[model samples]
Target: MEINVIEKIENPLLNRTEIHFDCTYQGEATPKVLDVKNRLVATLNVDKNLLVVHNLKPSYGEGKANGYAKLYDSEENLNKIEMDHVVMKNKEATKEEKEEAE
Candidate 1:
């Protein structure tokens, strides 16, 4: 998959950066948030721990996708505002949380 950043907007009130991007991939399957997060981290030269890929959706039968993501100033700030399920899906589960879930 290839990622191209289309736009970036800073939300000072939220202490986050909002991103819009496009992805080109060579398969029918939809791309995952983890993979998108990795690409965004590399492209933005930011820490993976500070990035959260909130959404990625492919255009039907087009092999292209458009998505939005949020880059937080800190994990604590992120947790205070972002939805629980989005945080859960985008970040790696902590050891304690992993153990509890298991």
Candidate 2:
């Protein structure tokens, strides 16, 4: 899969940077949400804990998807501004992590 960042906007009021991106996978299925989040963390050089994937929508009848993500200045701000389900969607929880969360 190839990811292209379409736009980035700094939201000072929210203490975060919002990103819009497109992912292209010529012959592959639409990537998983966690997979896309990991790629964004690596490509943007941001802490995974402070980044959240809000949504990723695959284009109809195409191997392309558009997504939105946010990079927060701190974990505090991230937790405060983002919805619980969205943050959880971006997390890659192992057995231990799942136990800890419970």
lDDT of 1 by residue, 14-99 (tens): 99999999999976577788888888899999988878888888888899999999999998998898998988788766799989
Native-vs-model 1 lDDT?
Answer: 0.88
Give the alpha carbon lDDT tens digit for every residue of 1-102 in model 2. 888999999999999999999999878888999899889989998888998989999998889999999999999999888998997888788999889999
- Say which candidate scores most in lDDT: 2
Per-residue lDDT of 40 in model 2: 91
- Cα error, candidate 1, residue 77 (Å): 0.7
C-alpha-based local distance difference test score of model 2 = 0.91
Tell me which residue pairs clash in candidate 1. Answer: none
TM-score of candidate 2 versus the correct structure, residues matched by position: 0.90
- Top TM-score: which candidate number? 2
What are the lDDT figures for the candidates, one per model? Answer: 0.88, 0.91
